[model samples]
Target: MFNSLISYLDSIRERDPAPRSRWEILLYPGVWALFFHRIAHWLFGGRLFFLARLVNHMSRWITAIDIHPGATIGRNFFLDHGFTVIGETAHIGDNVTIYQCVTLGGTNPTNGVAGKRHPTLEDNVIIGSGAQIIGPITVGERARVGANAVVTDDVPEGATMIGLKARSTLVPAETWLREFIPYGTPCDEPCEPNSGDRAESLERQIAELRAEVEALKAERRGDQPHKMSGTNC
Candidate 1:
């Protein structure tokens, strides 16, 4: 446990592997989040509801993140950057990577009743920046949520989700890592051609057809001689 803490600290440090001054690095963002979350989760589970709420509020104040105390997060859960929001009922598995502006929230409109209303992200899942996995959905193990995606339904194991309303682009683990690890390459797979592209292609085809029509009209004009209005011989 100590080693894990140390490693976690190191990851948040400048040199990563090398540890900096204990005093300075102690308040690293990730470490602070982990510590706060650990305490908050513990208090939440122990039936200290008010205290848990307080801790969660404090965490939000300090970290700019709103993680519900009731949310169950497993070990080595890394919230990399930006404002991450986890709903009160979110269930995050071990080794989950949540990036900036990612939200694991519920979509249920009813306020009173509650039972598993939030998303359950399975182990080894990596959610990219600005991804929103909303409602009581099970994002399967090893699933990858692409940047800026809005997912409402359940994602299968090892699936990669992208686009608005979220469509799955299934691929092998090795391929996914190779394409997505470094980031900034659009989506991982060859997504269906965008409407804009299709529209542009159609426009080009229309232009070509119009040019052909004009040429045909010119050829027909050239093929016929204009009748002389009053000429005879």
Candidate 2:
């Protein structure tokens, strides 16, 4: 158990550079939040609803991070700087990193039944500060949600999402190859350039498809003339 705790702190150190030592990481509210959550979750699974909620409320009061006792979190989940809210049906995968003021929110049920309402975050995913991931969408593995982005749909694997509606930006090979990207954004260039390139690429592919269709039409026209001449003969 001691070794596992050390491993958990070491994982946080790899993601965050501000902490000088493992002891400093122990002071982090996120770590404490997780510790409280583990006990709460165990109680919740055992049908001890009141006790689970009690622990959850206490953890939120202390850490300023609101994670429901029913939320399923995997190993090495890091909530950097707190102020994050995770919903009841949220399922978090291993090594998922979420920044301050991020929300894993749920949508209102249309059928009046409470089911899986929150987002499912896959392994190695990073969510930036103030980013709102709403509804029951699945954020694919290694996906990055940029700061202040509002995402309502499923994020593709290895994609970087940005902007108000959260569109995917084309990440450079170098940026994609990196193990971790701070704030889930590329440092060197603005997202507009990548968006523009993606737009141009899509337009080029459409033009190529049109050209192929025109070539096929011309070939059919030529064959029809040859068939008519043979019939006349």
Candidate 3:
């Protein structure tokens, strides 16, 4: 328990580039909210439903974050500018980073279904500000949801979900994680020089990766070179 608390503090400090003292982390609303969440979750697990909800409500009143007691959040989770709503049955994995106004909400509020209604985030997922991940979809490991992206479907591992409906593109999230992108901005690669659209560049890269994989497979089987497709290729 002590180890978990220490790790949580360390994670917030490390991920946030601000030079504030470690003592300031102790006063963080997210820290306090998570602290209350732990106690509430313990009570909920013990079948003290009313008591658990009471604590949950208290935490929400104190901190603007609204995380249900039933939600299972893993270690090293960071919530920036909290107003994040994690619904019941939402399962977040370790090293997840969520910005303000993000919602891991349910889709079928009136379906009367018995199973899980909230989304499940795999390890190292990063959700940008104002992003909404609805339903029981699984956000794969190391995936990223760009700012304000409404994701109702499952996201592939390492993919970056971007754009506002008319031009949503999925690229390798791991690609931009290598470079430093400022907080609250759309996740995009700064190194790419082509037309300034990071998604286009990543799409080209994805196509190249596919071609390389095919080439490698063909080499092992002693087959002829497979033709590569795409604008750049």
Judged by lDDT, which candidate is best? 2
Give lDDT tens digits, candidate 2, residues 99-191. Answer: 999999887654568898789999999999999898789999999999999887899999999988644555557655555442343323334
Mind giving the per-residue lDDT tens digits that candidate 3 earns over 150-202? 78778999999986532333445664443432132232224334445877788
Q: After superposition, how far is residue 60 of candidate 1 from its true place, in Å?
A: 0.8
Tens digit of per-residue lDDT, candidate 1, span 124-216: 898999998887789999999999998878899999999986444444445444322212222224545475787999999999999999999
TM-score ranking, high to low: 2, 3, 1
Worst 10 residues of 3 by lDDT: 180-189
Candidates in descending lDDT order: 2, 3, 1
- Minimum summed lDDT over a 10-residue window in model 1 is located at 179-188
Q: Measured by C-alpha RMSD in angstroms, how accurate is candidate 2?
A: 15.2
User: Residue 55 deviation, candidate 2, in Å?
Assistant: 0.2
Per-prediction backbone clash count = 0, 0, 0
What TM value does model 3 have? 0.68
